[model samples]
Target: MEKNEKNEEEEADEEFEEDYEIKILHGYENNYYDISKPFFIYSKENLVNFEILDSILPMNTSKNEHKSGIIECRYQLSCFLRLTRDVTEVTNNLNIQQFKYILMTLKFLKAVENKNITKLLQVLIFNNFFYQKDYKLRNYNLHLIQILNSSFFTQIDFHLKKNIMSSFLNSLMIRYDFYDENLIIFKNSKELFDYSMFSEHIPYKNLMINNFDAFCSVENILRDSNVLIIFQILLKEINIKSLILNNFFRHLNPDENFAFLISKIEIFKAFTISNYKIPASPFFLFCLIVSINNNIEYLRLENISYCRLNLRGLLEGKKLKGLILSKIGLTENASLINESRNVYETIEYIDIQGVFLNHSIWHEIFQSTNSSKIILHFNNSDIEEIFINNLKKFEIQKNSVLYLEIKFNSNTLPRGFCNSLIHFKNLKTLKLDGYIIYEDTESLLYKAIYYMKELECLVLCQNCRNTKPYIFLLQNSKIDCLDIQSTSNNNDAIMIEFFRLHKSMTRISIKDAKVSSLCLKEIFKQKNLIHLCLDIDILPPQVDQESLTFKSKNIHNLDLCNNTLKYIEGVDILSKLYRVHTLRISKCNPPPGYLSKLNKKCNSYVKILTYEYGILDFDDLNRIGKLGNLLKLNLLGCKFSGCSFFDLVTSCKFFKSLKTINLLNSNIKMKDFQCMKRFKKLKRAVFSFTEFNLLTLKNSLASLQICKLKFHTMLEDSNYNEFCLYLNESNIYILRG
Candidate 1:
């Protein structure tokens, strides 16, 4: 018994030690590659930077063409305006005139950013650089293109038309920071011909060659020398800015074909490679990155972090700007960072997460960034403290670092640590996460927060079991923005006091807190609460369901995610807000027939209803259809097998109101939907993982404007040819399984 106790104690200490500091962080996976979870929160959606209107909006010509151009722009703008009036319109119609759909969407988004029409849409679309909206938009376009390409290529005898391929590539090129979710839709050489032509029209800058989705190996995919020729053509034509060869190392065959492509495309502005395993000497993609993207400015290496390459050969005369050496370290006295200091003083951004750099070594690395600003991300509070304390050692000019984000792993920072932050008076943003605090932690920490008088945004998160209400500590804070996550709401008084203290906060994320419906009433009282997220799994019994309907006219977005609304009394409270524009509900199975009662009681002005993963019945669909203003209805992974999908579609009277009916991972039949009369209002019907027969069905899909179908059963050569022939004659798109 004593031995077991000792072993358990040792294990606990080890766990505590492990959590305190992360030596090497997979920041890439956390930020971009995690396909399991949604990339952004439901309320705070990351959108594209439509502010690049100058680039996307038709360029101005001479004064002679200005009037005619203005007329043309207005004409184009009107088309976009019509599309944005409802989400259904854009969703339903994208397949009909795909080029025009993409072009108008981009142009219309410029107006949305400018708030030219529809005040509700203008607010939802923000083009903030910090949000990296352009990246998200590319991902959306890529996913769409993946679906289109999968079906479109199967129809062609040889390859895609240049005009068609150019139109799609142009849509992908709008954003400077390009990413395409790297969905390699090309199946054979014929499709590769279309992909090869992409750089001919637009300035192809950013690219991720392979996104190891299901296809981990490049074995069967690259059948011959045809792909290599295409790669060579792309490199010679386009000036590559950012190149990401992630998920390529292990799968890349150690052959002359792979080596030839590597040797061909050698220079880029920035390069990133993550999750690569070192095979034989043939696995020289890493060497190719250093030698090739030869004009390298920003370089990031994750997972397989270390290399025995000669640092002098890689860094000697290069003007490198940013370095991300994650989860790996410098070997021996060959500290590459120190060597670079002689060439360039400081790299603009150095993100070192999951790796422990001892204080002395870290200080040397910190001193080498540019004067404009040095953006650094550390996952350990100890490392963060080391950074905070070592600021004086580095000769960074005053106000050089205008913002600093300090993220904590587990350590509740020492009081002096907070006090030390004020020295960097220009610090505008501070974020602390995962650290739990108790009553005895400190009141002085509040003074520490107060000292950063220039701080504009503060995010405090504590969701551990021992997390206590710590709102009183913010009494001295002048920060206007707060995102707090608490574990317990035992003290209603404390929560009320918290709202009272920061009553004017513009945005907030309250999740897993002991906040009940009554506490939410206090939250609704905030005048500037434009965005409110309620992610509680269960509301406490003390919640006042009969809580008075509050008038929060400013509130535009409401996200009720992963929370049970079955017990909540005032689920209809949202109906009272006329300004509510977007409502997202996910992963909550309510009691049968609850949606009908709620829809009748509430008249929510929700324009977009994004529903995912709840066994919704036909009545639920009927109830949702009853919403007077619901424009777009997106159903993902929800079973509709119990009731015929067409029965639900035919029953929906808001055919004009709901423009898009996208069903992914649900059960539906092709023949039943053939008699889709009411579906005329729907511009598009996307069926993914929905069981449908394409072999026996004699269904005419032309009635439903534009339809998309994904087949399940593998097709024989004759069947594939027949399927292509059938779809080519019809408006329906058959996406490959």
Candidate 2:
């Protein structure tokens, strides 16, 4: 009987994941207080002074801390509503541990009842624990069905019903083996779906389903209604990157509403299918193409995100507007030379990250892309031989300009390519990355620029060999901006000369430039140079600290990234620029003390600041709160904790002026509608690659009906019919890659 009991509980453990690790207070007991902690928001009767709380916690408080020996389920109910117990126990004495126990009891109640069950079952499903042995189960004593099914829950709002139902399922998943299988509530649902079939679970991330490839598709669980529930949840998450269909098509029921599924997934406006994966046959490809051929415009193929693959032709369904084809490794021996030529004449943009083709295939690709912008990234040194004769044939499209992003693999470029560039007098922007270049190009590249009077922007990125181009562009081109990368001591002389002619140059950016601290003095001499970015080699870390103080009076924008630094002397020097409105310190981990120096010196003039890939603490938040004119903040990919980031924003006066914010790739919690509730002037926000959740997120955020940013596909719920209707009515622009 004990063995049977263990077996039943093991089965229960298989279906539900264990609870997440509990949160411990960040600071130690003594360190936590004396600082004067605020009272819990829900329990505070009024704003009262806290004489410091106690110094330590009792051990094993994970066990209930209530005065009674057992956990009072009624206490858990109060916390479910975000409420807490009385503050009568606030100890003025530092020695007392009473207040600590008060917090522990509240935490215990919060943990026992606030079981995010849906998330837990997700772990069990993916980890494949049902097939394992000796897994134990723990049960919460509350009868969830009795409480949720009561008249009190029945008359509640429909969304609340869903939440309650979800809570019941979460608890049920963990306690299934412990509960009597013959219990009244263990019967069939209104849809005749049997609960005894096992509890449904959905993953937190987008469902990464694979049969041979999908770990979730085990033992016919694919047919369960839970699969649809997970899909429905994913649709609401708005994380539509790519939905692989390999396992999807293989195990799907023929009678299923695939059309309805397709209709609900209207967020997908781009598609890619590669022949490299599992060797998909032409016949199956044809059927797959026919099924999805109607809606998408942007298409790419193969392992192009990382590598390359075979060129798959556009079929008879939808005409692609932009196509990304990479590493189309066609050989003379291949039979499908004629098969790959299904080009769409209407296509406008083409991006080839890598390509290896003979003359005929190369000609066909260029002919296919007659769009306004064509970008190609190639590492092959022999591209000149492939296009030497053809370069001259390329026309300067009327009213169109040429832009080139050239990286040198060898000093020897096709001798004719740079010579041929001059023929297209319509070249407007030229960006050359010569990190690997050794040969001098100032004569040829500069002479070409001298002739293209239409040239407006010149970016010399990495190993910019000679100074002549900067000096020559002064008279030859209608240039407004110059972005130079990786300057040497020789390039500093080039900059010295360029400054003499940069009175009309409004923007300048130089990265990894090995120049002295005095270069700022020369840079500040240019009256019209409003924006400047420098990655100087600040050696001896505190080079010229006391003597070299920042004093740029007119320069308005500054960026200092990609360099190692030890102090704020450079920023303190640069902060003297009264007009400098945009500042970015990114891709480098400068100490927070360095940031503090910047905040202290330039908080008033700097209107926009972007910091990335660094440790972010409340100090940074507090400093950002001091920037009086800050209009935009892009804190992308920074490591930060605490749920009250936005709460800080609303309370601080300096952050009131913020108009645009990019929190991409960050974990942000707090209601979207409530967090931005105070930023009335806030018009735009970029939250791509972010996961934000709150109690009111789905309801309140979606209800913003007129989310001035015009949320058309913003709510990418998995119902396509409704999405399509919204799309038809929406005039809002949706950006796609």
- Cα lDDT tens digits for candidate 1, 533-578: 7676435555655664454556677666675454353546444555
lDDT, candidate 1, equals 0.48
Residue 167's lDDT in candidate 1: 29
How would you encode candidate 2's per-residue C-alpha lDDT over 1-737 as one tens digit per residue?
00001222233333122221223342223332222442232222321211111112223245553111111221222222221233332222311122122223333323223223223223322222122243212121122222232343333333223333343333234221111111112111111112221211111112222222222222133233343344333233333333223222233334533232432244455554432332433343444445664566666543422222334434344566666655545334332235444444555556565565556555665554545445556567565356545665544242343555555444344435667766657767666664333345446655676777777778777543444324455454477788877545655555555555555677777676666545544565455767777666743333454554443456777776766343344445443555567878787776543454453556677778888766666666676677876777787766664433564575455534666666655555544335654554444554532332333443333422222232222334445345334433542223321
Candidate 1 TM-score, C-alpha based: 0.51
TM-score of every candidate: 0.51, 0.44
Q: Which candidate is the best by lDDT?
A: 1
